[model samples]
Target: MIPRFNDHAANERTYLAWVRTAIAVMAFGFLVERFDLFITYASQNASRAAHKLHMHLRLTEWVGLLLIVFGALIILLASARFLRNRRDIAHERMEDYAGPVGEKLLAAILVLLGLFLVVYVGQELAALSSQPDM
Candidate 1:
C-alpha cells in the first residue's frame, strides 16, 4: 500500500490547486457580472432614445449574473469533491482499493457536471433567442 503521508500530501496539494482554480473562476464571474451591472445602470439613466440599448444592456447583465451563478456552483461542487477525494486518499483501506467506490462516485459526478453545463448553455441560448433584436 502507498504510504499515508505521501498520499495525503499529494491529495492536499491537489485540493489546493482546485481551490485556486475555483477562486479564479468565481473572481472572473464576479467581474463579468459587476461590469455588466455598471453598464446597465449607466444606460438606464441616459436619454429616452437609448431605451432599446438599455434593454439590451439589461439582458446582458442578466446573462452575466447567470454565468456568475454557474461558476459559483461549479466551484462549490469542485471544492466538495476535492475534500472528499483527499479524505478518501488519506484514510484509504485495503478494501477501498478493490471496489473503488470513491473513484466511481467522482466519475459519476463529473458526468453530471458535464450534463449540467450542457443544459445550462442550452437554456442560456434559448433565453437569448427570446430577446428582441437590437
Candidate 2:
C-alpha cells in the first residue's frame, strides 16, 4: 500500500463529491433550458396563447447554458486538483497544498446566481400582479 493511502482516499472522495455536484448543476441547467419548451407545449395545448404582460427576456435559457458550461469547467478543474493533491500526498508535501480556493469561488458564484434568481422571480411576480385579470 502507498504511504498515506487514507489521505489519497479522502482526496478521491472529495473528487467524487465535486463530480456529483457538477452533474447536478448540469442537470439543473438542462431543466431550465427545457422549461421554455414545456411552457410552449402547455400553451399550445390550452388552445390560447399565454398573456405576456412583459417581454420575455429569455435569460433562463442562456443562464442554463452558462451553468452547464460552468459545471463542465468544475469537473475539469476538480480532476486536475485531485491529481495534484494525489501527487502532493504521495510526496508528503501536503503543506504546499493551497486551501479550497476553487470551492469557495464556486460557492460565491452559486450565491450570486441564487440572488439573481430571487430578484428575477420577484420582478416577475410584481409584473403579474399589476396586470389586469383576463
User: Which candidate number has the best TM-score?
Assistant: 2
Write down the TM-score for model 1: 0.50
For the record, the alpha-carbon RMSD of candidate 1 to the native fold, in angstroms, is: 7.5
TM-score of each: 0.50, 0.79
Error of 2 at 83 (Å): 0.4
lDDT of 1 by residue, 62-121 (tens): 655665665566567667866776767666743244365644764675566546546754
Give per-residue lDDT, candidate 2, residue 60.
68
lDDT of 2 by residue, 1-134 (tens): 77888998999999999999999999988876665664454344343334441133367678788889989999999999999888888888736547778879999998987787678667655655565555
Once superposed on the true structure, which residue ranges of model 2 sit more than 4 Å away at CA?
Answer: 38-57
Distance from true position, residue 93, model 1, in Å?
3.8
| Candidate maximizing lDDT | 2
Candidate 1's error at 6, in angstroms?
2.2
